[model samples]
Target: MDTQGIFDSSSTVRDCSTIFALSTLLSSVQIYNLKENVKEDDLQHLQLFTEYGKQLKKDNGKKPFQVLEFVIRDWQYDYDYAYGQSGGEELLAKRLEITEGMATELRELRQHIRSCFERVTCFLMPHPGFEVRKKSFAGEISKLDEEFKTALKELVPSILAPANLTPKLINGGRVTARDLFTYFKTYMTIFNSNTMPPIESIMKATSEAALLAAMQVARELYETRMARVTAGLSLPRPALQQEHVAALQAARAACIDKNKMASTKDVNESLARLTQELEALLPQYLLINDGNLQKALGEAKDAYEASVRRVHGADLLCVHPSDLQTIHNEAVAAALRVFDARRKQYPGIPDDNRTKLLESFLPRLDELNTLNNEHNRLFVADAKLSFMGEVERLLARDPPLGPYEFRNEYNRAKNRAVAAFKRRRNMPSTYYADVYEDDLLRSIENRYYIIREINRNT
Candidate 1:
C-alpha cells in the first residue's frame, strides 16, 4: 500500500492511521453480512473490539497487519452506511472525503469568511441587509462560467449601486472630527486593498460624497439662520437683542469648526466664506429694537435722575437756598434735553454708535451734577456767615432810632435772616419759629442798652 501517498493526499484528514486501523478490524468481522439488517449497538461493540485487536497486533510487531485491519474497518463502515440506500456509490464517495479534521477545518474557514464579509459590508456598503444581498449576488455569479465571473468583477461597479453616502451623526447630533476621520480612514483602507477594484472605488467615492453632502446640509442650515438674522436686521432699532447676536455668532463659529475637517479645499473655503459673510452682516443686523432701546434709555434716565437727586440732597446740607435751587433746575433741564435728544436720535442710530454716545454722555452728566452740587454747597456756607455779619452791623447804629421803629426794623431783619437760614438748611418754615421770636426779643433788649449808652455819651 502506498501509505505515504494516501497520507499526502488526505493531509486535511489528521490521524488517518486510526481510520486505516479501524477499517482493517471491521473487515475481519465478516460474520456480519453486508445485506443483513444489523443492530446499531452490535456494530458499536464490534468497532470497540476492532480497536483493541489493532492495538494488540501493533504491540506484536505486526505493523502490516495493523494497516490491513484499518483498511478493512473503513470499508465495512462505509458499506453499512451505504447499504440499501439510493445513490449508495455517490453517497459513499462523498462521505469518504469528510473526515473529522476536514469538517472542523471547513467550519473554521466558514466562520472566517463570514467575518470578512461582515466587515466589508459594514465599512463599505453601510446599508440594510447589504451583506445578504451581496452574498446572493455572489452565489449567482459563482453559478456562471469563468468568463461570466471575470465579467462580473469588471461590471461590479455598474451592477452594485453605491449606497446613499450621507454622513451620520454619531453620539447625538454632535459629529466630531474624530468621527469623520474614522469613517474616512476605514474607506481609505478599503480603497487601498486588493479586493474588487469597483468596490474599492465605490467606498472611496462614497466617503467623499458623504462628506460633501454633510457640508451642503450644514451650509443650508447655517445659511437659513443667517438669512433670518439678516432679515431681522433690516427692521427698525430694538428688534435684535444682545442674545440674538450672540447666538448668531456662536452658530457661525460652530459651522466653521465642524466643516474644517473636510478633505476638500472648496468645502472648507466655501464654509469659511459663508461664515465670513455672516460675520460681516453681524454688525449690520445688530439693530436694537424699540423695546430694548427704550429699556436702555430708561435705565440711563433713571441713573441720571438718581444722580441728580443725590447731588441735590447733598447740596441741601450747605448750599445757599437761591444757588442750590438754580443748580438743581439747570442740572435737571440739561439732563432732560440730553435724554430727549438721545431718544430722538435713536430713531436712526446704529446700535454701536448709540452705545458709544450713551457711554460718553451718562458719566459726564453724573460728574457735572456732582461738581455743581459741591460749588453750591461752598457758596451757601459763605453766604451764611455774610448774612450774620450784616445783621450785627445794622444793630450797632450810632444815632438812636425810635424804640418801635427800631424794634420793627430789628424784627424784620431777624425774620429775613431766619428765612435765609431756613432756606439754606432745607428746613421747614416752622422749624425755628420759636427760636426766632426769642432771638428777636433778646436783640431788642441789646439794642436798648446800646441806645442808652449812645444817649448818655452824647
Candidate 2:
C-alpha cells in the first residue's frame, strides 16, 4: 500500500477502544516512520552522522544508547529526504534495512551505524571528474579503462538525474532503481539522436580523458628512466668504457622516441629538452672519465713543483745573458709543457681549475726572469769597481817607476784584477767580450793618470 493508505488504515485502527494500547503503539510507529520519510535531504547531515558516530564509539562504555540516539537523530535529520515523495519509499526502506531498537553491544551498534553512513555516502557522493580521477590514479594508467567504467557506473546516475537524487537516504525523497534505469535509457536515446552521431564527441571526450591519464603515466615513467640514464651518463663506468658514448647516444635516441609518442606537448617538450641537455653534457662527462682528469691535475702539480726547484737552484750570476735567457726559456717551456700536457690529457677540466693551475707556476716564472735581469746589473758593477781598486793600488807603490816600467806593472796588475773580478762575481773570464775589454783598458789608463798626479803631489 501507498504511504497515505497505510496512514489512513492506522488512523481507523487507532479509533477502536478494544485494542487501544496496541493500536496507539502501532499508530505511533507509523507516524515515526512517516516523519522520517518526510524530512529534507541535506549534505551537512553526513558530517553530522560522522561526528555522532565518533562520539558514540568514544562513549561506548558509558551512556552508549544516548550517543546512539544522537547518531540516529542526526541521520534522520539529514537523510530523511531519501524516502520518495512519489511512492518510492518502499525501495529506499528496503535499501536501508535498518532494524528498530538498539543492539545489546555498542560495537554492533557502531558497525551498523557505520555501514549506514557508508551506504548514504556511496549513494550521494558525486562521481569524480575526469581530471580528478586521472590525478587520483597517481600516473598509473594500466587499469584506467576498468577504473573509468567503475567511476562512470557510480557517477552517471547522478549526472542523469541530479534533481531526484537526495543527500540523505534515511528520510529524504527517494530515487528508485527503476527511475535511474529509465533516466539512463532516455539519456542514451537523446545522445544517439543526431545524424552525425555525437558518438564522435563521446569518443573524443573519452579519448582525451584517457590521453590525459596516460600522459601522467608517461611523464612519471620518463622521469624515472631519465634519472637512471642521467646517472649512468654522468658517472664513470669501467665496464662500459668502450661503449659509453654509444650508450649515451642510444639513451638519447630512446628519449627522442618517447618524446615522439608523448600525448601532451608539455611531456614531449620536456623529454626533448632533457635529451638535448644530456646530449650536450655527455661528451664532457665522458672525456673527464676517459682521461682521468683528476690524475692529470695531480701530475701537473708535481711538474710545477719540480720546475720551481730547478729555477731556485740555478746560478743566475755565472750564466751569460744568452744562458740566462736559455734557463728562463727552459723553465717557461717546462711549465708550458705541464700546462699543455694537462690540457691534452684533461681537456674537459673546468676553467676555474685551469686558472688556478696556471697561477701556481706563472708567478715563479716571472720571479726567475727578474732574477736574471738583476744578475746582469750586478756583474757589470763588480767588474768596474775591481778595475778602479787595482789601478789605485799599483800607483801607490813605494818607489815610483818610469812610464815603461809603470806600463808593464799596470798591464800585469790589470789582467790579474780582471780575472779575480770575474771569479768574485761568479762570471766566466770571457764574459767580458772584446769591446768590454777595450772599455776597461781605457778606464784603467784614465785612473792610472789620476793616481800618478796624487803621488806627485805627495
Candidate 3:
C-alpha cells in the first residue's frame, strides 16, 4: 500500500474512524498506480499465505489466521509520527521530523549507491567536463558519495531476492515452489547491471584516489603564490633612482680606465690565468662561480685596450694640446685619476700577478674613485671629451651639475651588493646535510596523506 510508510500507533477509540479513512485513501492511491502484472503477483502471494498458513495451523494443532503478523514490541522501530491531536502533539511532531529526516537522508544515499555504478564506470570511459572543486548542481555528486556508504547495510537483505530463486518446498507448500521462480525473475534485472558489488570492491577497481590527489596540488600552489607576493613588500633595496645616472656612469668609466693604465701588464696576465682556470672549472663543475670572476676580468680587459692605443703610437703620450688640460671636472675624470693608464698605454702588453694583487690593485681602483670624487667638489665646466678647441673654451662650460649627489648614491649601493655576495660566499656548505633535497622528498611524502586517512577510517 502507498500507506506502507505511514503507520499510526495512537489507538484512540474516537480517532479510529479518521485513521481508517486515511488508510483507505492511501490504499486507493497504491492500487491505482499498480500495473496488472504486479497486482496479480501480490494477489498470488496473499493466496499462498492464506492456504499455507492454514495448513501449518492444522499440522501443528493450533488456531491461526492466513499469515503470521506478530508485533514484536522491542523490534518496532517506527519512523512515522504517532499522532491523534493530544497535549503532546509537539513531541510527536519532533519525533516525526527526526524519523523523516533520517529516512529521507537514507533514500538519497541509496540513490547514490545506484548512481555510482554509472559514475564508477570503466576506466576507458570518457569523463564529463565538470570541475570537482565545486558541485555540479545541488550537491548531487557529493550527496551521492555520502549516501552510498549509509545504504550498504540496508541493501544486504536485497541479495536474498536472488537467493530465493532456488527453493525447497516442504509438504503441501505449492506456492513456495512457484514464488522462488518469480523472485529470481525480478532479481535478474538488478543483477545484470553489476551494481551489487560492495562499495570497497568498486573503489578498488577504479583508482578514485586521484580525486584527493588533485586537491593537494591546489592547496600548495595557493600557499606558494601568497608567500612570494607578500614578500615583495619588504625588500631591502630602495626604489630605483632616475637622476644622477650620468654622473655615476662618468665616474665608473674613469675608474675603469685608471685601473687599466696602472696595472696593464699585471691585469692581462691575471686575465689569461683566470680564463684558463675557468675553462678547467666549467668542464668539471660548471657553476663553480667562474662566471662571476670572469665577468669582472673581462671589463678590466676592455678598458686596458682603449688606453693603450693612445700611449703607444707617440713618444708624446698626451699628444693633443687638449690632453695637457686640467685633470678636474665634476662630470668627467682627468686622465690621472686612473693609475693603470701609466703602465698600459701601450697595446699587446699584459699585466703580471703582483704578490699583493688584491692588496695593491684593489687600493688603486679605490684611489681612482677618490680622484673622481675630488673633482666633483670643483665647479668646472662640462668638458667635451674630444681633442678640440681652446682650453679656455673647454673650462668655461657649466660644471658637473649634480656629480657629488649621484656618485655617492651609486658607491653606497655597490658596496652593499658586494657585501651581500661576500656574506653568501662565507656561509657553511648546505651539502653537509643536503637539506634542500631532503625538504623536496619530505614534500612528496605529504601527498599520500589522503590514502592514509582512508586506511585509518577502515
Candidate 4:
C-alpha cells in the first residue's frame, strides 16, 4: 500500500545486483531454484548471487532472497589482441615491453662501443711493425770525431772553417776522416745533433709511438668487453642469453701491463669512466623497462576479463523460484492450519455472528502465517483491500490467479462503490465510504444466501 516503501525495497534490490556485477569473472546471472537440484553451472551463478545478497543483508540486516541484477562491460587490448579476440594479451605486451626496451638500450651502448673500436684500429698502423730504432744511434765516435782536430782543420781551409761553410778534398776522390772532420768544424763537437741528428734517436721516438698505439688498442678492446658485460647485466630477467663470452675473452686479452708501455694513470682512468657510465645508466634502464612491463600486465588482466561481461542480458533476477517455493510451502502449511481451525469454529457459531467472526479473523490469520515468510522471500503480491482505487482495480482485473468463484462477489461490490461515488459531488466523501462499507456488508451477508433465493412463488 505504501508506494515509497515499495520503491525503497526495489532500489535495495538494484543495489545488491550492481555489487554482484563487480565480479571480474562471473559470466552471467541465472535464477536458481535452491529447492531443486541445480546444475553445477547454475549453482556457480546462484552462489555468487547469494554471497552478494548475504553480505548486503549483513551490512543492513533487513531482508534476504532478493532480486539482484548484474551488468558486464567488455574490453580488450589493442596490440596484444585483435578487436574481439582472447588470449594472454597482457603477458605478451609485458614481455615485448621489457625485452624491447632492454634491447634498445643495448643498441645505443653498442654505438659508443663501436666508435671506441674504430679509434683503437686507427692507431695500430705504422707502429711496432717498423723496426725504426735508427734515430737513437750515436754517430761513429772513433773516426768521425777527430777530438783534437779543431785547430788542425782550421788551417786546412779558413774559408771552409767559416760557420755554415763546407769543402771537399781533391787528390784522392774518397774523402778522409780528417777532411770530413774539417768539413764539419763545430758539428764534430756539437754534442746533441752534430752532423745529422742520430738515427738511434728516431728509433727511440718510433718505439715510444708504437707503444702508445698498442695502449690505445688495448683500451678499446677492454672497453668493448665492458660494453658486452654491461649489456648482459641490463638484459631482462628471463631473456638473458649466454653472456657474450667472446667479448669477455677479448677484454681479458686487452688488459695489458700498462706500466711497461702506457700511462698507468690513463689505464685506471679508462676503467673508472667505464664503471661510472655503467652505474649511472643501468638503474634507469631497468626502472623504465620494468615499469612498462607492469603496465602491460595490468592491461592484460582487463582484456581477459572482458569476456565475462559480454553475455547475461539483464532480465530475470528474483528470489530464485526454488527458494521462493520453499518459503511458500512453509507459509501455506502454517496458514492452512489457522484457516482450518477457524473454519471449524465458524460452523459452530450463529450465522450472522460467524460472518463477522471470520472476516475479523481471516486477515490476521493470513498475516501471522505470512509475515516471516514474506521477510524470508521478500516478494509478495497478495491483494489487501485497504485502498479505494486498489479495490476497484482488483475488481476490474479479475486477476487470473485469484479464486474464480469469488470473481462475481468482488465485481458486485466494485459496481456498488462505482454507483455510490457517482453521486458524491454534493455528498461528502465519507458518504462513499458508508456506501463502500455497506457493499462489503452485503457481500458478507450473501455468503449465507442459500437455495431459498430461487422460488419467490414457492
Tens digits of lDDT, candidate 3, 260-284: 2223554344334433433342222
- lDDT score for residue 377 of model 3: 20
Instruction: List the candidates' TM-scores in order.
Output: 0.29, 0.33, 0.16, 0.20
**How many clashes does each candidate structure show, in the order listed?**
20, 12, 17, 12
Please, what are the lDDT tens digits per residue for candidate 1 over residues 159-211?
A: 23464222233211333455445444544543454332342243334335445
Residue-level lDDT for 174 in candidate 4: 23
Give the Cα-based TM-score of candidate 3 against the true structure: 0.16
lDDT of 2 by residue, 1-458 (tens): 11332234465432222122122111211112222232323222222233433443353321111111110111232233331221233324443344567344433533544443323222222122355455466654454444344534644453347663333111112223433333334334433432322423433332233233333333444445434443422222433232444554455454444332233565555556555654565465456544554555567666655654564454544444444445545655675566555443223433454556566666765665576456654654677677667667766777766667767777787786556544543334344453334555666667777666665564
Model 2: what TM-score? 0.33
Candidate 3 lDDT score at position 17: 29
What C-alpha lDDT values do all the predictions have? 0.41, 0.42, 0.28, 0.32
lDDT tens digits, residues 1-458, model 4? 00222113455644433322222111111111121111233223334334433343344343222221111112122243321112222322232233445555434333322221111110000111112335754543333323213322432242234552322211112233443333233222322232322323322332233234333445466445545444322333222112233433343344333213234665565545544544454455346435544443334333322321221113111222233334334444443343333221222234332234335434543443454234322212111132234443543543332444445545565555444433321222322233333544564346323311221112
Poorly placed runs, candidate 2 (over 4 Å) = 1-251, 254-270, 276-318, 345-373, 401-405, 424-442, 452-458
Ordering by lDDT: 2, 1, 4, 3
Best by TM-score: 2
TM-score of 4: 0.20
Better model by TM-score: candidate 1 vs candidate 4:
1
